[model samples]
Target: MVPQLILVTAFTLYPIVMTHVYSLFEWPGFGPLDRFVGLRNYTRILADELFWNAFQKSFIFMAGTVALQLPLALLIAILLNSERLYGRNVYRTLFFIPVVTTSAVIGIVMRSIFASHDGLVNNGLQLLGLIDRPIRWLAQGDTAMIALILVASWKWLGIKMIMWLAGLQSLPVELYDAAKVDGASFWQTFRHITVPLLVPVGVVVLLFSMVDALTAFDLIFTMTEGGPGFATEFMELYIYRYAFTSFAGGLPQLGYASAAGVFFGVTVFLISLVLSLLARRASQVRR
Candidate 1:
């Protein structure tokens, strides 16, 4: 615990303090933090239309991840965990391959695969007569948003599946045995036993999924670069661009970026804290 505390203080606490301190100044990621314009960065961030838009998009992405990805992962996990399944290990490995692969590489590869004219997506759709013409997936805002969600869901699918698998495996066999003896149907057993017991795991999964969706950056950066109009822009990319990319009209805004980072970080932390308390309450109720 001593060593872990030291590491946390050095890495997490130190960075957070520095970020807040930097947010109070007009620093250009360089030598002097001379200009001390307190709270201006936060004010500007709140007033910025782009910031709000990006924040909204983050919520949309988060919602999509929880609503779409979690259920699919749970379903896949249940199927793979079934005792009657053959070669389940092979299936699990194949499903989990994306989690281990580099997200940037996957994004770059997926971009080409979804390209309009000659891409595999378009080709396949045409082959199946799904559409009369090629669709520019990354060129449109709505389609780009969908692509972002799909890529994110696909990348984390294996991880969430594994988490669910662990929870399912930990469930006591006697419950199922008793259910079987009572002549309970599979769905009835799952609803009354499996679902109720997995509440704690569900809470953990919810927390992780929210954090991952909010902080999604690498694949998004490589895939669209927030293009096709700022439609796919997320808060993480928003902060990175301000911190790194200098505009022709303005200098690089390290302070502004730091403010945005702190703002979102606080928001996420509050949400997580609330969820954690709820999870605790859930555990108590279960007991």
Candidate 2:
């Protein structure tokens, strides 16, 4: 426990504390940190329309992930958990493969898969006569965001599925037996017993999915570069753009970026706190 605490303090707490401290200064990420701006950076962040736009987009991504990704994963998990299914292990392995792969590498592969005209998806769609011409998935703002969401859903589906599978596996077998004795249909058993029993795990998955959506940067960066004109520019990309990407010899806005990071972190913390309380309540209700 001592070694773990030391590691946490050195790696996680240290960076977070330094991020908050950096937010108070007008540092250019290097050389000097003499200038102090206090709350000016935070104020500037609040006033920045681009930040607000990215905030909205971040929530949009979060909503999409929660609505689409989780359900799909849950369905897959339920299917894989069925005792009647043959080769369930093989299916689980195939699905979980993407979750373990590096997001950047997946993004690179997705870039080619979604490319215009000759791209795999487009070509397949064309062959199927779904459209007369190929859709430019990454060349447009709305479509790029949609593509990002779809890719993210596919990439993360396995993780949430595994979480759901774990929860499903932990459910009391006697409950199912009683449901069977009561002549309850599969849907009835699922709705009355399974759903309520899984609420705690669902809450955990929800929190993680939301945080992942909020901080998703590398894949979007590697794939879209925040382009088709800021279409897929999420909060993470917003911070990276300011912190790392510079234009015309301008210094990086390290202070401003740190402020944004702190803001996002606080937002995540608050949401997680609420969700955690809800999870506790859910567990209480179940018991």
Candidate 3:
């Protein structure tokens, strides 16, 4: 147990410790660790307007995801939980295919599909006479954000559906029977029974989406790189740009990037803590 604990601590905490140490220095991430810059990197991050924009984008993504994603999952879960549904196993497997696929591949697919003027989405819209010309879905600001939100929701909804299905199934049957015996209507039973019982599942899904939004990198990286004028710029993508891009002294800002990463991590951590508290409060209120 002691040896296992030591390994776990080393594997997890070591990188974080190093990130903190590196953040205090002006290193290029490849060369020798340089002299301490004290809190310069952190201060720079604090002053960077781009960083704040990314942070705002992350929250927007979070709101869009939780608003649309989980309810869709729950609706599907309810449908899937119905005993009348045929071939439930087949439907479950089909939906979960996206969840099992490689995220990079998914990002690539999304990028292509949402391409401007020539992509499948635009082509379909043109066919439907929705627009005279191809709208640049990924190149525009509000629409680009909406595209990411939809893609993120689509890619993750299936897993949440399965989770909610499990939660629904685990719910004891007697509760429903009693509700029906009390002459409760379908809506009444659903409002009273289903909602109350599924609070835990909601909390879990909210936390999952929150962290995913906070640290979203691959999708945004592959999709936009926070581009078309930083409209869709997210925190993780912003850090990558700062650390790697050669935009005239942009590259080799390792200390600043690490500071940004630590700031993002701490921000997400505190948000998650607040959500945990909110979930607890909600559960208590329901009780």
What is the Cα-based TM-score of model 3? 0.91
lDDT of 1 by residue, 130-173 (tens): 99989899999989888888888988999999999999999999
- The runs of at least 3 residues in candidate 3 whose Cα sits more than 4 Å from the true structure, single-residue gaps closed, are 1-7, 248-250, 277-287
lDDT of 2 by residue, 1-287 (tens): 99999999999999999999999998888887889999999999999988998888889988887789898999999989999999999999999998999999989899999999699999999999998989999998888988889999988889999999998999999999999999999999999999989999999999889888888887888988888877778888899888887841498889899999999889988998999999889988888
Q: What is the lDDT of candidate 1?
A: 0.91
Off by over 4 Å in 2: 1-7
- Candidates 2 and 3: which is better by TM-score? 2
Instruction: State each model's CA lDDT, in order.
Output: 0.91, 0.90, 0.85
Give me the runs in candidate 1 sitting further than 4 Å from their true place: 1-10
TM-score, prediction 1: 0.95
Worst 10 residues of 1 by lDDT: 244-253
> What's the distance in Å from true for residue 3, model 2?
6.5
